[model samples]
Target chain A: MTENEINHIFQTWLKQHKALLFKIVRSYAFNEEDRDDLFQEIAIQVWRSVTSFKQQSAVTTWLYRVALNTAIKWTTKERKHQDRHESIDVSQHIIESHQPPDDRLAWLYEEIAQLNEVDRSLTLLLLDGFSYKEMSKILGISESNVGVKINRIKKHLTTKSEKS
Target chain B: MEFKEMKKIWDTQNDEALYVINEDALHRRIKAKKMGTKRKTSFSEVILIVSNLCAGGVVIISHLLKNSGNVAALSMGAMMMIVGAYILFMRSQRIKRDQQTDVSILGDLENAIENINYRIKLSQSMIWFCLIVIAFTMYTVLNSDKSLLNIILISGFFIIGFFMSRWEHKRFNLGKKKQLLDLKEKLINEFEM
Candidate 1:
């Protein structure tokens, strides 16, 4: 109820859920520097918005809402100035860094990178074991829509994997 | 493996190995008011709107004082400010619309895809505005001085500018629109709808 209580609670949530920030950021940003920047941006947003949080939704759901909004807004701006990224294959970066050892995870990331911004967010939430109802609440969509979309998305990806 | 299985895998890959989330560092960054990432779109938009307003203010003030009859400057300034305001409004509205989805992934996809369309619209309108400004300015110049050579040269320049804008649309914005469309379709297909 008190401001300090809300602040303390939010800080704890943020600290414990640092990985939430990372998962959301990686879906939006292209490189290490961009990821760091997005993470900072999301953190600032959380800091500002957490006090106003009504506690109507789960803290993680609310956090995802804020993070996704920031990422979507940031991506729209970045898209205008970024060079043709396809021109530069990511294999070089893959070589240059400690890579994702799991090929399935790696493939998942690649597929996610190709997705539209919102789909990417939904997929991230889905992969994090969010229920359809929870995703619906955060995304402002219906439960059945989430279920149908998730089913379709899974079928789509699996079909792609099979064809390849 | 199933997608659920993949998610299970994703949940397991913790960030402890590399860059840990430094709460102290985040607090410092938040306190410093450096919330933005490296890109400066908001900053630049503010700069753009301010500059346009100043330019418009100067032109309108000068015209009122009758320093010169260059009404083109007033129109250009006014038009640019309108465009800037429209862009700023759209962006703010998108950000402020609360949640795009809470019940469905389809809602999220639709909102996201719609945002891309909005962007394409922004770029298209900007191009048209520039062309209209150029056309109006040239007409004003022609009306002020009616000479054959001037007409010929001005028409030539206008034609060149017209073509140049078309080229720009093809070279830049059209390609972007196509990409967005493809992505939208991909999302649609992802849901098998």
Candidate 2:
């Protein structure tokens, strides 16, 4: 496909599923700058990979896989040189406040950020309404494993929220 | 709450906070792919120059020492072998680092570090091997006289390169270890909070 055609498809995907990309980036980035960097990196990667995008899976599934993978890598890389920046406090970005979190949905996101990397990806895919088969394809896991993990994540989130 | 109720809440959650990409800017960036092209071109140029210098130097030294018989040939062969090995090792390391950067998953960090450590060891060994080769070359050039001055120079360079590489490897390992520790701490704090 031509670059223009790829750009058109990407624009449509971005408009429809931008929130998913944003949330994944936010969860993985240490700060706003890191989020923006990851956003650009993911966009570049998606653009590069779009030519090979077969319609075997939904666009949302492909996008989530790319975005999550990008964020995870970004976090891992950043963690190495993070000590150099003594002034940039990570705690500032942690969502902890008493403003009711703008509703339980915001609180849900705050909690999602607390999950481990694999669990966070699984939970985010579940929230995005991916079927077990789709989750399996995106995560390279078995459908049965997806079902088991999702059930465990649900219980874990409940206990976590109740304690809070 | 049960899974069903949790799903219900998740279904009803607002997702307006998600930021979508600006397609126009992205298109512009795609159109301006010159930077990547330039980087590749410059990288290839450097590799070409270094390879030429290494090969040319080996050829000239081999020819000059031609009258010295098999020992000179062996020294020349060993030098070329060292250079070829260094080039191959560096190329492999570059490819590995690129691949590591392309994929982003937490589980890959350890593998990346292991690759880095392997590269460091290869580099250290390369330095020592080159030093030994240089010492042999000097001894051959001096007709096995083993000049003290040449030995000092060869040993000095070897010691310096050895210590420098050793320091670099230590620093890299320390940095990687600290990063893993920080990641562990972050995960704990996030879950605990």
Against the true structure, whose lDDT is highest? 1
True contacts kept of each: 0.20, 0.16
Kindly provide the TM-score of model 1 when superposed on the true structure, using C-alpha atoms: 0.49
Error of 1 at A69 (Å): 1.6
Q: Can you write out model 2's per-residue Cα lDDT over A1-164, one digit (the tens) per residue? A: 76457667766776676666676775676555466556666765565567778988878888887887666666678453323322333323222112223456666778888877878888888877789999888876778877888888988888877886
Global fold similarity of model 2 (TM-score): 0.54
Where does model 2 exceed 4 Å of error?
A78-101, B1-193
TM-score (chain B) of candidate 1: 0.48
In terms of lDDT, model 1 sits at 0.63
How far is A87's C-alpha from truth in model 1 (Å)? 28
lDDT measured at residue B63 in model 1 versus the true structure, 0 to 100: 71
Model 1 chain A: lowest-lDDT 10 consecutive positions: A87-96
lDDT of 1 by residue, B104-139 (tens): 222332344355455456546656765786776676
